[model samples]
Target chain A: MEDFSIIKQQDEILREIEERQPMFTPVQDFSSLEVEYASNPPFQAKIPYLQSKYSGFRRTRGDGNCFYRSFIFSLFEQLIQNKSHLSNPDSPYSQIYSAIKQKVLDSGDILNAAGFLPICYEDFIDMISAKLEMIPTTEISQLEDDFKDKIIADTYVMYTRFIVSAFLRLHADEYSGFVEGYPDIVSFCNSEVDPMNRECEQLQIIAMTEAFQIKAEIEYMDRNDRTETTLMSFPFEYTGPDFKIHMLYRPGHYDILYPNRS
Target chain B: MATRTRLLRELKGKTEEFSLNNVGDDLMIWQAIIQGPSDSPYADGKFTIEFRVPENYPFAPPKARFITRIFHPNVHFDTGDICLDVLKSDWSPAWSLEALCRAIVALLSAPNADSPLNCDAGNMIRAGDMRAYNSMARMYTIEFAQERNLN
Candidate 1:
């Protein structure tokens, strides 16, 4: 009675929904929710509102169950796909950046309480790529315009977080005691260390200079295959730490020689 | 019928009845026994493989594992996880089951060492030590797949 035009618009949207039914036919099966609820009576007791909302409101239990399951399933699917993308070597760095952006958007109370940002594996690659570009190479000027500062900054922070997290997960037995002790290593390292500065690069060079330091540590800690060595070893122009930088070596693959440390 | 379904039917008629006993609704797990391709390290071998289809179906790619062990850079030793992209992110829903089976058979012959599932195998292959890789392949074939009976 109030607005005939608004009612017509609503009807148009409803018609669109009806037209799209065939496209969504696979997801239309919600009858199983009723059977699931009947089998598991405790679920109704725990979430009485769910039962009330569906059954009391004259909506089928199957509809509620299907909707919930589909939502949960899609969420998990996205997580796995994102994780796989991160682990994939061939995936472009931008994919990881977008994933990080999505994580920032999706983050809420649970992630905030955990005190960590959700970053996919590709984010790690993006971080490494950024730091690698900043090593003041003779070839630095030749780098593509796409490889610039903010990307480098974001990547560096994300990479450090990934490394610290991986180190913690891998060496939980050796480092679990230190978990409570060093609650904010990634944040502290990122803020205080300044990886962009010459000092941090020197520190990284020193750590890497020992033959098999990164390799042995990563192998022992991560338990992942050594295949990543080639990908991990790029970036480290000598910061005057009594070490000879070897070219023609793979990125993640390196054999560090530390004459000073020895 | 879908191209995949049709292709699957054709392959089933041509090949021996190969199926896995244990599988869930989410996973369309199958055990395949493939005859080795000619002029390959895996020639004259009958290799076994396992396929796992995810619940997300066409969106997320399925996972494939070698049930019968083989010495290859693209496959793990203890676990049979393959390192090929076709099975991973590069997978397309357009890929047919027959094509996947053929690819698996082909992978037995040629392995990409640049991206290796087994570092030792990759190292050996990269070093051009084909003898070592072949011997290892032969050994695994004998140990895991009863290659002696095939010959």
Candidate 2:
């Protein structure tokens, strides 16, 4: 009980910190990371290489759902920036948005198959669809402000987690072998994939990229022997030239990355 | 607001083993009655559980406590807190109170002795004293959770 009380106190402190900090901070220069990691040689060594390829980054709250938050926020930001070409049905942005919208609408079937009752997930899915609908019409600043609303942001993360879990469940035969500790795919999804604030892993990343039909690249900044941060792309076979979302991963946290100036 | 709406919808869904009702029209605080699993020592018992839904319902799990005393490895004898993963770290927004009721009913039958809130009950199961464990649990159910006693 004493241990439990200590944990509860720590959680209160973390929650207080979370309230003071923005859910997603505005774009910050790569030099910010350099200063933050100055004492750590391995991280400092990779900053130059990272800077060469990426201009700036948007910091996400260190909550466990950072990966999903960063990915969705970055994707929506891109779509909003391309709003000029939205009227042109032939434009790549328009095509991508249309395809994603359809996927969101069709996700009900996946959730149903995963044993989720429609009554439970309908509100979450509606919030996700409403936000997606706002992208073309809404300004970038509005998108950031909307995400700052904890309920709205958490609702999106929850739905996205469901999508990831459902995808893994549907393709259990393919992923069951890769799952390490859990007895089977269902239990793995129950504990690891569906829970709020659970960190995402490689399997979840693959599942998200595949289920949403979005390409992503992660710049892994680690304390390894390598001087440069490794760039790993999801959906392994996709050697595509364009990735819809780019993220910087340092240890447990993830943040959105912006491309270098042309 | 969403929590209230979801609870209203869940009130309509039917389940034989458990039923949940609001406490004096308070949507956030619910009262649930769970029938013991037929094969378990707790059979014929009707356990009362109090569920306190946090403001962020579905996102955060509702706090469930066994109001009626029961001898089990996972439920606290004094505080009534049940040591269940779904109520804590494993919670998903996809789960409804109805689902939680079902999970609770399942937990009564398969109490995890490894992570016990009631050490005495847990030790009994761990020591392979099935006869003593069953009888003690059965005695508690009759004393505190029997249908007549619950009323």
lDDT for model 2 comes to 0.86
Which parts of model 1 are misplaced by more than 4 Å? Answer: A1-262, B1-27, B147-151
TM-score for every candidate vs. truth? 0.33, 0.94
For residue A216, give model 2's deviation from the true position in Å: 0.1
DockQ score, prediction 2? 0.61
Q: After superposition, how far is residue A217 of candidate 2 from its true place, in Å?
A: 1.1
Chain A only: TM-score of every candidate?
0.24, 0.93
Residue-wise C-alpha lDDT for candidate 2, range A186-223, written one tens digit per residue: 99999998987778989999999988878998999999
Would you list the C-alpha lDDT of every candidate in the order shown?
0.42, 0.86
